[model samples]
Target: MTAIYSIFGRISETIEKLAAIHRLLPWILAFALLLPLPQILSALFNDYYIYLANKICIFILLSVGLNIVKGFCGQVTVGHVGLYAIGAVSSALISLHFGWSFWLAFPIGILAAGLAGIVVGLPSVRLEGAYLALATLGLGESVRIMIAVTPLFGSSTGLLSIPAPTIGSFTFDSYTNYYYLVLAAAMIGIYLSFSILRSATGRAFMAVREDTVAAAVHGVNVTKYKLLAFVISALYAGAAGGLFAHMPPGYIHHNNFTIIEMVTLLLMIVLGGIGHIWGGIIGAIIVTIIYDQTLEFYFYQPLLFGLTMVLIVIFMPRGIGGMIDRYLATKKFIASQEEKSNAAS
Candidate 1:
């Protein structure tokens, strides 16, 4: 462990030096590298990999939102997928029935999801823990059921022929084009999430999560922060859903936003590390890849996912992100100790 820490410490120092040369250097490099992923996947593998990449980006958004509410705010919400459903269906309907452009309908979809977040969050003001979980679960399921039964929501036929987004002459109709759209949105969502997590409001959220009573005593406005967390998370879900809906061959089914999907999102955050900043992104990428690889075992996927979550919670409560954080901390401590010893001598 000491040897490993020493190696990591040196690597960390090098990365920090590189970062210090230019704050956006790392981000610029990451963007440049990721920007070619679709083309590379298409050339090396197939366009199917590009599709999978798009799915990964969408789930990244969903998982990040879930982490905000469940991981950071410590709110148990199982109804997030409902907001995703609402966003998709609403955006589709607006484009389909009302003849609105996809661009116009997208923001409305986000707003609608935010409004539903308030409804889901209202119960939180009076409930906590399992009760809140149950409330959210019920609400989420109810949204799916409503879409399944209502004709306006397309019912069993599902919403179909929804148009792709366009800007002037160019339409995001191809897989590669749509991949860029989702990628840009996912990147923006991640950057905004980091900004939020580092802000005063983020600190207030952690305070509330650590102890609601203590947060209230400190004038943190616990209820307000709780609702804000839900709304912010809903916005992410809505954006993801809207993007999914607007993809080429745009269609949305009731089953797409079911509790199973919610469970998948939960597995993602758990695998990554609940409260760790990059946990959602890491978990989404890994889970989506594993899921695609194990498509033959579709029947047992839920059970496997649930068992994995259980194992992670029991054996690695902090998840992968937490493990990385601990490793880094240890490396820093070891480096500081070495420096102190040399100074003393």
Candidate 2:
């Protein structure tokens, strides 16, 4: 174990050194690798994998946003899927009924979701824990129920033939073409998330999460930061929803944004690490891939997922991200011990 930890520590140190050499080196490398993913998937497997990749990107946005409110701000919001539904339906309706372009509808969809976030966050000022979770869960279910029953939302038939995004004569209707659009948005969302997480607002969010009363005592407006977190998260969900609505063969239904979907999002964050920065991204990718792979076991899928969550909670409460952090910490400790021993010699 000692030898293995030493080796891993050396490797991690080398990577850290490389990353430190350029401010954007990790990002540049990530993009360079990710940019070719669609092509690689298309060649190695099929366009179906590309579609899965696109879904992963969308879920990445959703998971990241959820992490902001749940992990960072300590807000227990289960209505994020509802916001996603609102964004999808709003964008689809605007394009289909109002004859507006996707560009116009997308922002409107995001705004509508942001407003909904404010409505959802309003209750958080008075509620906590289970009460807050129940409130948000009810809110989320209500959104789905409304879409299921309302004619304007296409009821059970769902909205179909939603227009694909276009720039001049170029329509992003193909899997590979649309992948670029989603990829760009996902990357921007991640970059912005990092930016916000490093700012004063992010510090406020962490403070609020750690202890609301202490944060308040320190002059942090807990209510303001909590609401801001929700709104920001809603924006990310809205954008993801809009993108999903405008993707190739654009169609969305009430069933698409159900409690099951919410659970999946929860699983993503849990698997990644509740408060870890990369938790959402890592969780989204892993969950999506596992889901795709387990399609054949549809009946048992939920059971497996539930079991996995339970095990993770019991055995690895901090999650995969936490595990990685521990590994890195162990490696650093080993390296420092070696350095101290060498100096003594």
Worst 10 residues of 2 by lDDT: 1-10
Tell me the alpha-carbon RMSD of every candidate.
2.3, 2.4
* After superposition, candidate 2 runs with Cα above 4 Å error: 1-25, 340-345
- Model 1 whole-model lDDT (C-alpha atoms): 0.89
lDDT of 1 by residue, 200-310 (tens): 989998998899999999999998999999999999999999998988789899989988899988899999999876878889999999899889998988788888999
lDDT for each residue of candidate 2 in 102-128, tens digit (9 for 90 to 100): 999999999999999998888889999
lDDT score of model 2? 0.90
Per-residue error (Å), model 2, residue 265: 0.8
Ten contiguous residues minimizing lDDT sum, candidate 1? 4-13
Q: Which candidate has the top score in TM-score?
A: 1
